[model samples]
Target: MSQNGAGVDLETSLGYLLKEASSALRAAMEEVLRPLGMSVTHYSCLELLAQRPGLSNSELARGAFVTRQSMNVLLQALERDGYVTRPAKAPVGKALPTRLTPSGRRSLGAATAAVRSVEVRMLAGMTETEQAGAFRILRSMIRSLNDGDGNA
Candidate 1:
């Protein structure tokens, strides 16, 4: 393996591995989410809002690892679909907060079940200890790649 301009070897690059794994992960998650009438993107937004309960579009974007502009476009669609609400305008005249509607919560709850089912299948070959160790190793690798900057 040789380092190129980006300081990664094509033959043994973390980016390549991560990209492939992420694609697979999304595909599996999407398979589960689709039956619940949701895309992975929409489910992610709903899950984030469910957890934080009133995040601005920008904040939700960052938390969900998406661009602010992209998040706003999705939010608009969700709002139109009656899956989310924007409440009143923000006090700072900045980004308004978004939250899931009852329907969104119900749909996301169903999708969450499907996601867990996929996770169980993905981890079927591993023992509980091995699963934890795998999670630790991946987290360490991500931390090393991110350093202190994160994906921001």
Candidate 2:
């Protein structure tokens, strides 16, 4: 924000706004997850794996919006923690699919519930239709950003 007309400056770009929102939401999530002995990244990955079991490393990376190297490291750590297990489907280098162990599935269920609880609390004042509208607006923003044409 600045002394300008709209009170938004370069620092208030849409990317910055989204990042700030993410930070706030993540803070709330971390508060809820701390008692469960899980970090936000761990919880997110577990949830994603639960939704798409046996997703390949590359697919998981893209879905997680991270690099393959980072995904591999996270997978290794989760495997060590018995949260996820990777059975060798083929040669490791090309495309190795990973599956969630039973423990991983359980963790995902718990984390998903916890996240939804937090989200509901955060959206308490909003009606269902308002919630839907907010989500739709966010999705449209993301689509427009990714499209880069701004035609819509």
Candidate 3:
């Protein structure tokens, strides 16, 4: 309960703090990516493709935390810009596997560097041990929430 016993106290809430941190991180990433003509989602898609080529639109959407429709639109733009390509027809199913073109790989290199700088800046104050501990804690939190059984 809050100090007034009414609801959550934003001043002392970990959830609120986490959200603020996420917002700050996103803002920092946007600032860096804007000059490269990329949004976080755009960068995410390219990174996903680089790591796991031949991912379907749905898979890319899930990985990037965007809707399938939004991913499709982004894919269309990427295809038109020669950053990615999809076959004229699905070889196995309705899902057309997408792959990054050479151009996409080149663009991803710059975005990766810019994103890395933001991450490096974000972690400047934390020690290696602290960073590792934070990573474990965050992973545990995600697992607990995903489990949905109050078994953290």
Best by lDDT: 3
Error of 2 at 126 (Å): 0.9
Candidate 1 lDDT over 47-152, as tens digits, reads 8998899899999889888899999999999999889999766857687978788988887888888888888887888998998998999999878768867455
Error of 1 at 17 (Å): 3.1
- CA lDDT of every candidate: 0.85, 0.82, 0.95
**TM-score for each of the candidates:** 0.81, 0.82, 0.92
lDDT of 2 by residue, 8-123 (tens): 56576887788897898999999989988888877878878888887877788888788888888888899898988777555556687778988888877877889999887889
Tens digits of lDDT, candidate 3, 3-79: 58466878887889999999999999999999999999999999999999999999999999899999999999999
**Clashing pairs for predicted structure model 3, backbone only:** none
TM-score of 3: 0.92
Cα lDDT of model 1 overall?
0.85
| TM-score quality measure for candidate 1 | 0.81
The deviation in Å at residue 133 for candidate 2 is 1.5
lDDT of 3 at 97: 96
